[model samples]
Target: MNTRNEYIYEFGDFCVDAVNHLLLRRGRPVPLKPKAFDTLLILVKNRGRVIEKDELMELLWADTFVEEANLSQNIYELRKALGESAREPYYIENVPKRGYRFVGEVKESVVAKHADKVEEDSDKTIKSLAVLPFKPLITEERDEFLEIGIADTLITGLSGIGQIIVRPISAIRKYADSSQDPLAAGREMKVDAVLEGSIQKSGDRLRVNVRLLSVRDESTIWADKFDENFTDIFTLQDSISEKVAAALSLKLTSEGRLRLTKRHTENAEVHQLFLKCRYYWHKWTPESWQKSIEYGSQAVSLDPTHAPSYSWMGASYCTLGIFGIVSPKKAFTKAKELVEKALSLDPTLSEAHEVLGAIKLFYEWDLASVADSLKRAIELNPSNATARDLYALYLTAIGQTDAAVSEVKQALEVDPLSLIINTDVGYILYFARRYRQAAEQLQKTLELDPYFAHARYALSFVYLQEELFDEAIEEINKAVTFSGRDAASSAELGYAYAVAGRSSEARKVLSELEKQSKHGYVDPYHIALVYIGLDDKNHAFKWLDKAYSERSREVIYLKANPVCDPLRSDPRYADLLRRVGLP
Candidate 1:
């Protein structure tokens, strides 16, 4: 009964969607009679200008002989739907002896419509796609877990398709806000199409409505609705993937078909827990990672055969170890055991292999096995951004700096919004000793998230290399504060102090780090960094030995980290490199 238009109007919390013939308040649809919506559209279109009652009735009814009362009734209904009393007249104001005027301040936005195409042009390929988070049926009450979970599942199902580039969850998470326009998101992501949807849950059942839209022409490529028990979510996912693939005319390979229909766990509850775990994991904070572990452990306990749960937990532990939130030995041991268990259960698990590869590269220092695992992980799922990111790190460790940069850049294409990925690109450039380029890259990363301590800490390294001591100290100092004075950030601050001739402050920071190591699992490598800065070669070598004996995570960066430049000419440095298996 409604025709689409390439325009939308926004005022306060309401969106007048001429394109959909719907009035949404705070992202939830409000029921309005067809005639009432038509009247509202006209008033909003001609806001701040009054039309006489005769003109308003004639425009709405055309040749039909409609009474003035009918037009007045529509206005009354519009006012009620807008939550305004006629007397208060916030949105609709009646001019004496004239038609009503829309008083609300409106912001108009035009949806760009691509050039018209004939039926032959319908064969245009849908190469890249984005699945945005679903909106809830109720605006005031949200089920964020379910909303993100469904989109994430669909993303995973389609990611293995080589013919299509499906944007990862990290890149699409920002669209979780229901207010986001799907086409706008698609344009920003530079994707061919977008899958936008809404979900409603009642008791043990769900009602979902989804439509795949073309970003080029705003055409509906495919649309569907599902009503089923919540436990049947797997079937919903399979149906959606099949329909989308068919709509796009993708001739799926056997592997892609299998991937689309694969079920990691039959138990719906365990699936929900796994989704919650991943949701928190992407938050990329110490507290969030801990929460991720808790949820992942719960999922694993509930369904031990859920390989993804184990792998995700392992990944969380790996991150904790790298950030010094957990001791290296304890964290790596737990992470390795978990991922190994995951591999034993599901040998083809891409992320499980990724986690194993990271453990081999960073903890065991088994360079021989690292490449195989990472390559296998990527071969299984080319869209696994984390695998590519870790592979970049491995390449950097092996002195393949150019390959490492390429790999990280590829990872960015998959998850352009990932804070860690952005930071890693700059870090990889830093390790390559391209100080100016690294500084530029890190500054861009800071623009993405100014308070991201990791980016600031990395930018500090770039500043230090450029001999910008004051800037380096300021950056690391902010990094320390932003990271809640984490040991890694504090150690970097100490290094900046020493390099800038603030030996007393550097020693103060070193003293605190030593105190921390006495009680907790502080990486001695951090202490060594300060020693190297202080030009205390003997003490630096002493701590580096301890680091090697302990297999500190930071040891992998020895071949490239500029902070160790002072000791590079020493025979001990060569011996350490030989012992660590770095050529």
Candidate 2:
């Protein structure tokens, strides 16, 4: 019966992740409404035989009164979604005046559970936990960043303890409501316990109230209140983290103990500025990223020895470069310099190593050496989900699908609610050539946040691979709109147009990109994508060469990106891969 794990049904190129309620074909999602999918599932389950219409209707519409039209509509939608024609059906066969049956050969396989299963937290001796963002007690005098920043710091401290799985701030920040129940949030996060609190400020005095609640029993495991001088936030964070760890009965190593009390900057004001930088950084918008860099730069100026500030600033620069908000050459160069400075100042900083890994991967194309930096970052901070995600990306670029999927899955466990990590999962699956699974995963991400541009952009790739050009163009159009016509999304939209056989529209996009390039930096790799889509091999190679010369971040994925499939057989592609040193 396989009670512990669910199953995925594979037939031809289609996969049905039954537990996730996802249907994908050739790694691209086939969007069927609930009833349509249910209808398809029943047919697939009863394959090699036909079920009577009356019995099938009863199975599908149990305890509900539904007409024959409703059942017929579901079948119609299922066939449409699956691209199954009525006259010559490859999958679903309609039994004349009787019922329906799936004609394709089906293979059922159990979904492989991860070693560190998040869902079984209650049964584990070592607990999984989440620290919800501390609400502001005094609404009129609230410092939003400080309130959330306190919880972020606590999560960072507790993450060093190998005995506990502390959910990253990104996973729990959404539970910031003053009236939200900690137990409810804990249950939603699937953690054994939750640490939640409130922050209040009055002149030079700062006060915080916190409680650790057991999700299983809805009991307060520990509770406390602290009143300290505003400048003593470092001691406050240390006290809270240590007390929570003690309450959990975690056996922390000496290094974990030190990590609990570690301070990047002694200057409280500088720390505040750095927290502000982090606050904006997590917003994941170009303007917010710019604001993050501004705050980080201010922190650096205020306390030149604050290595975290430099690391975060470097991260912001790297993100901007990757997003094509600025020239990759300019952004990555500055990012590399800042990250190197951060490393020189504080060699143990995990974030610096993560940023350095990204710089090495995207800028230097130093695939051989990138693993060391990424691994070091994870070693220093196991809860560094971003580091794990980037490492997964590096693994994908080097053609290690299984390792990449595993690494990204671990990242998802740590920060399950992170939009970017969720998108990265789909993106990696896309590179793995599991288009259906990619589409399913990405569609679920969109369910989390419909307006997330990157998820849409990633889904477009899955659609392109499936030759669902209209859906691809539609998804990329939303991505372009959501991302404020960001060059990357805009470029992808052009590629979609070209691939869809809309040459005039694709050329129009190319012309627009050229004009935009005159005013601001545009990745040559983007132009190359459109050229490839248009089947202009010469033009594509020209732009790709430019991208190579500029060390554009997008070029690093040459080995894995399906858009570059057309170029792979070319000698120039092999030379590019050799020059970039990618295996």
Q: State in Å the error of residue 371, model 1.
A: 1.3
- In model 2, the runs with Cα more than 4 Å from the true position are 1-126, 486-489
lDDT of 1 by residue, 191-260 (tens): 8899999998888888999999999999998999999888898998888888888887876766669887
Residue 86, candidate 2: alpha-carbon lDDT: 87
**Per-residue CA lDDT of candidate 2, range 1-583, in tens?**
1236667999887999786577977765554545678888888878888988999989987886546755775776677667777887889888999988888999998866543453554354436889998888877777779888998888878886545678887787788777888888887777888888888888888999999888887788899999999999998998999999999887565666887777888899999999999888888788998999999999999899999889889999999988777888899999999999999998988889999999999889888879889877876777789998999899889887656886798888877878999999999999999899999999999999999988999999899899999999889878878767764437788898898899888888898887877777778888888899899999999989999998888888999988888888899899999888888
Give RMSD to native, each candidate: 21.9, 15.0
lDDT of 1 at 29: 62
lDDT against true structure, model 2: 0.84
Global lDDT scores for all candidate models: 0.86, 0.84
For residue 248, model 2's alpha carbon misses the true position, in angstroms, by 1.1
